[model samples]
Target chain A: MNPTAIRLSPLDNVAVCCRPIEAGERILVEERELVIDVAVPIGHKVAFVDLKKGDKVRKYGMPIGSVTVDAPAGSWVHLHNMKSDYLPAHMRDAAGDQA
Target chain B: MMSGWLRSDGRKGIRNAIVVVYLVECAHHVARRIVDAAADPRVQLIGFPGCYPNDYALGMMKALTTHPNVGGVVLLSLGCESFNREALAANAQQNDRPVETVVIQEAGGTRKAIEAGIAAVARVRNLVDEQAVRVPLNISELVIGTICGGSDGTSGITGNPAVGRAFDTLIDAGAICIFEETGEMIGCEGHMAERAATPQIAEALVASVHKAERYYRAMGYGSFSPGNAEGGLTSQEEKSAGAYAKSGSRPIDGVILPAERAPGPGLYLLDVVPPGDPKFGFPNIVDNAEIGELIACGAHINLFVTGRGSVVGSAISPVVKICANPETFRRMEGDMDIDAGRILEGRATLDEVGKEIVALIEAVAQGQATRSEELGHQEFVLTYKSSAPSGPSCMPNAA
Candidate 1:
C-alpha cells in the first residue's frame, strides 16, 4: 500500500495526489475522509475541504491563485479553477507606461 | 563532510571531467565520436553550433573551459568555422590543464579526428584522475546553481520554495548560489530587485531583467513558455515568482556572473539574455543552455527543482533534483533526489527539504553520484549572441 499522502506547507489547503486517484476513492486528509470523483493525475492537486467561488487557494500559506469556480471536498483543484494573483499582461504594460 | 578533490587554483572539484567541445556545428560529430570512443562518463561533449563570431559564445566557452568543474578540455575544430579555436585552447592551457586541438581538415578527416579525440580524452582522463589531491572544503566554498524545469502548479508552492529555502541555507552558510533565466524572470523584476543586497544593485538588477524582456519580446515568446501555461501559470510574473523562490530569500549579491569569473560569494543572477540586443536568436533555446551558463560561471553543482517531472542534470556537475509535486515524485522517484513535494501532502516541511539538499550537496561533493549524473545526462549547448557590459550597480559596488 502506498502509505498516507504528503502535505506540503502548513498553509496548504490541498494535498498533492501522489498516486493517481480514481473515482469514488476514499482518501485520508488529516482527519477527514474525502471521496474522489474523477481521476486526478499524479502531481496534480486535490482539495482538502469544500471550496467556494473566489476562495483563495492557499499553498505554502501564500496565495498561489484563487479558485475560480466552486470545488467540493476531494475534488480536483487545477487550471479549471485556480488563477494567478499577479497582474495580467495588459495591466503590467499599463503599469510599465506609468513609469 | 569528507575530503574533496583539490584543483590547482585553490578551488575543489567533486568530479574531474575532461570536456570535449566542438568549435562549430561541423565538428560536433567528431567530438561525439571521440567521447563515445573514450566511453568514460567523465569525458563529456559540449559545443556551439553557429559558425559566426559571437562575443557571448566565445566568452562563455572560455568561462566553461576554466570552470571549477572541468579538469581538462579538448577543442574540436572544422578549421574554417568562425569560432576562435586557438584562443579557446590557449584559455584551457592557461588554466594549467592539459588542452589540445583537433582541426578536422588539418587532422586529415572525421575518422582521424575521432581517433585522435578518443586518444586525447583517454589521456586527459588518466592525468586528471591522478591530479586529485584530497582537500578540506567547506559549505562556504561551494558554488551552487539552481534551475527549474517541467514546472506545474505545485512548483511555486512546494518545489521552488523548497529550493529557495535551501538557497537561503546555502547562502547563509556563505555558499555561492546562482539563479538565472531572465526571460523566465519577466514580471518579478521589481520584487526581485527589492531583495538585492543594495538599492543600487536592485536598480541594475531591474535593468538586467528589462534587457531580457526586450530580447524575448523581440523573439515573440514570453519567457513563460507554452508548457508553463499548460501547468497553470497564467503570465510571466507568476512563473517568475515560483522560479524566484529557489533563491530562498537570500540577498541578491550581483548580476550576470561574468563568463569564467567566479563571484566572491553569496547569491548571483546569471544574466543569460543578451546584454545588448537579441541579435543571435533564442535566449537560451533549451534548459541545458542555462545549465551551461552556470557552468561557465564556475558552478560545481546544480540544485534543479522540477514539478512537472524533469529527468535531467549536466555534464560537468551533479544536478540535485528536487521534486516539488508529490504526485510527480511518486511518478518519477528514480529521477529525483529530494521530494519537497512532501510539503504539499503534509508529509515533510520546507526545512526538511533544505537540510536534505545540503546533505546531498556534501555527499555529491564527496563523489556520490546524483540521479542525473548516474543516468549519464551530460547535455551541453552554446549558440551566438552579444551583450553590452552591465553598468555598475548590477551588483553591490565591490568593496
Candidate 2:
C-alpha cells in the first residue's frame, strides 16, 4: 500500500502528507494507525501525536514551530495552528504590507 | 572527459560569454540595445542601477567582469555617473579579457550610444572567440552552487536532499560546492555548527546565522514570503530546515561572504546578508540577486531547487531547475529540468534522483542547454549592500 503520509524523522511529532487525505480516513504511520481529523493537502503536515498549546512541533527532528491551539493526533498542522518562533509568516495579502 | 574554456587566471569555464555591463540605470537602455543587436546567445547583459558609487557593487562588477565563464566585457557609462568606469575597464583588461567602454554623454546620447555599444560588443565578442582556449575539464575542477526559491515542504524530502546527495558525491570528487542564503538557514545553525570542519569554523557558522537573524529582525522581515506559506510551509524555521537540506551531510569547510570564491574544494556556506546594521534594504531583493552572487563566487553552474516553481536562469552561469512538487512539475514541465517530485510519488528513490542530478550536471557542463537557458531566461540583478570582509576564522583552512 502506498503511504499517504511520511514521518521524516523518528523524533518528529508530525508526518507530511504525501497525497491529499480526506477527513475520517484511517492512515498508518509506521505501525501506529491515525484517523485523519481534517483534510490535509499534499506537502502539508499532519500531527502524529497529540499537541497542546505552546508545545513545539517537531519535523526533521527539529522544532519547526509551536502549536497555538490544542490539536489531537492526525489533525492538520499549519499556519492557523502554529507560528514561527522568530518571525510571523506572511500570507499573500500581507505581501509588501510588512512594517 | 569534458572540455572547458580555459581562462588566463587558470580557471576553466563550461561557457565563454561576452558580457555587456551598464554602470548606471541611465545607460541600461543603450547597453540592452547593444546586446539585442548582437543577437548572440553567448552575449549577456548585467548592470547596477545606482547613480551613486557603492563599494560592494563595484567589487561585484569587478568579480563578474573577470569571472571564469566571462571572456570579454563591454561597459556602458552615462559619462557622469560615479561608477568609476576607468577602474572597471582596467580591472578586466588586467585579467587579459578584452574590455571596452562606451560613455553615453561622450557618444552624444541614446541613438549614438547604442551604435557605439553595438560596435564595442562585436569587437569584444570577436576577440574573445579568437583567443578562447579549449582544455580538458574534470568534475573536480568545477565549482557548483545551490539555492532554493519558491520552496515548500516537499523541497526538504525530495529536491533539496537529492541536491544534497549530489553535493556529497561532487565534494568527494574534489569539486567545490556552495550552499547559500544564511537568512533561510536560521534554525539549522546548531546542526550546521556541529558539521563544521573546526571549532572556529563552527563558531563562525553560528555567528553568521545570528547576524542574519538580527539583520532580518531589524528589517522586520525574515525572508519568509507569502508563496512559501501557501505552499504548505508554516514558518521561517520550517522553510529553513527544508532549505538547509541542500547542503548535504558533509563537514562544512568554511563560510565565505558573497563574491568570495571558495578557498578549496569542499562544502562552503555563502553568507549573503550584509554585515553591520541593515542599511541598504534587503540583502537580496530577488532570487536572481543571489544567483549573481553565486556566479561571482566562481560557480560554473547553479542547482536551483523549487517546489512552488521558479523559471529564472542566470546571465553567466547556467541554472538547473529541480521541481519538488509533482503537481507543479506537471503544470510547468517545460520549465523544469529534474522532476524530484518522483520521490514524493514513490515512483523513484532519492538515490536514483541524486544520481540523475549528477548526470544532468555533467551533461550541462558538456554543453547541454538547461530549460531556462533554452527559453532565454538570462535574469540578472544587483543592489546596494555593505559587507565587511570575512575574518580569519571564517576560512581557517585558506592559505
Candidate 3:
C-alpha cells in the first residue's frame, strides 16, 4: 500500500519495480494479485501478466518497447526480453535518434 | 517562502549577473582571464566560440547578454570577427544596463584586454550587487527550460517523467515552461501533436517535428545517438518519448527558438533543428546548443534531465540536473541537482520529487547559485545556421 511503487497508467502491462520484490512479497496491482516470480530490481519493470517473447512491453498505456525474449507473469521485464520498437535497424549511436 | 530579483522589464530575476563575454573564439582567453580576475560568483564567463557570421548566434548572444538575470555585461572582442559587437552593445544599452567592451587588438593585446575586463567586471559587480533586491514573485512569471543529455533507457521512465511532474506543477502555477530539441522529437509528432491545446496548434506542432525529421533525414543521419544504445536506449522513437516527457502534460502553446521568448505562459516547444541545409554542419552539434536555445528563449533557469550524466551548464541560465538512473546518479552525484531515481528505489514518490524540484526552483530563483554555477561552468557556443520561419501550421497561437 506504499505510494512509492505505482502503476503509471492502468493500460500499462508492467509496473515500475520501485522496491526490490522479495521471493514471496505479495503485492496488489489493479486488484490483481501478482506473486513474485523473480527478483525485480528497482527502476526495472515487472510483468502484469503472462507474456510471450514477441509481446509488446507496454508503459504509459503505449508500447514503449517489445519483448526480446519470452517473459512470464510476475517476471522482471528488461533488455533481454524487450527492445525499442521505434528504431530497430541499428545499435545505439549519438545521431541515431530516428528509429 | 519564494522571492525573486526584479528586472527592469518587470519580470523577476533569479540571478544578478555581470557577464564577461568573448565575441569570438579568439577573445575567449581574455574573457576567461577577466572573469577569473574578478573572481566573484556573480561575475561569470560566457562566449561564442565561432568567428563567422551567424544570425542565430547573434540573436542568441543579444538575448543572453540582456537577460533579466543579468545586471551588467562586458564584451571581449578580437575586433575582426563579424560578431556585430556594436549591435550587441546597443541592445544591452536599450536596457539601460552597464555594458563595456574591450577589443584585444585595440587594447594593446590580451593582457591589456583582460585588465580592462577585470576592472569593468569589478565596477559592474559593485553596481549589480547594489542594484539587486529581492522582489515578491510568483510561479506564473517564471520561464523555465527542460533539456536532456547523456541519456539512457531510464531517462524517459524516471528523469524525464519526474521533470514532467514538476513542469505540470509549474504550469499549473502559470509559469512559462519550454522544452526543446526538435531533432529528438522525431517519431513523437503524433503524441506531441495530440497534446496541443488546440487543433490548429496541434497541426503546427506536428509540422515542426516533421520538419526536424526531414532535416535530419536529409543529413543521412538519425537523431538517436549511439551512446544512447549503450545506455539501454534501443530506438530513436523510444529516445524521443523519453525526451518528450520533459514537456509535461501541458498543451503545446507554440514553438520558439534560442533567441526568442514565449509570448505568454504555458508549454512552448523549441525547434532546435536548423531550418535548412547541412551547411550549418550540425544543427546542434552538442548539448550546449540546446541550452543556448533555452537561454535565448529568456529562460532564467533550466531543468536538465539526464540518464547517463552531463556536467555542462550555461552562461545565462542555471541548469539543474535531474538524475534518472541510479548507477549514473551514484557516479555523478556532485554534478546532479535531483535524484529522480529515488522513486524507483522506493525512497520517494513522483509527487515528492516533483515538490523537491519546485522547492529547488524557488531556492535557485531566490539567488542560490546552482552546482554548475559554483563550479564555474559558464559554457557558451554558437555556430552558423538558417531556419525558414515555421510554416503557418506551426505556432497557431502566435498571431
Candidate with maximal TM-score = 2
Which candidate ranks first by lDDT, i.e. highest?
2
Worst 10 residues of 1 chain B by lDDT: B225-234
- State the DockQ, from 0 to 1, for candidate 1: 0.14
lDDT (tens digit, per residue) of candidate 3 on A1-99: 453245667877777655556766777777778877776645456788888888877766667777877777777665567876544424544234653
Error of 1 at B25 (Å): 1.6
- Output the lDDT of residue B346, model 3: 61
The digit string of per-residue lDDT tens for model 1 on B33-108 reads: 8888787798888888888788878888888877777888888999999999888888878778878888999999
Give each prediction's DockQ, rounded to 2 decimals: 0.14, 0.78, 0.24
Fnat per predicted structure, each in turn: 0.12, 0.71, 0.25
Better of 1 and 2 by DockQ: 2
Count clashing residue pairs per candidate.
Answer: 16, 0, 19
User: Candidate 2: where is the Cα deviation over 4 Å?
Assistant: A96-99
* Cα distance off (Å), candidate 3, residue B186: 2.5
Candidate 1 C-alpha lDDT tens digits along A5-87: 44557777766665567878898877688888678766566788888889877654445567788989888777676665543
Q: Write model 3 residue lDDT over B279-329, tens digit each, in one string.
A: 777688788878878887889889988877889888877988889887778
For candidate 2, lDDT tens digit of each residue in B168-227?
A: 999999999999999999999999999999999999999999999999999888888888
Segments of candidate 3 deviating more than 4 angstroms:
A1-59, A64-99, B390-393, B396-399
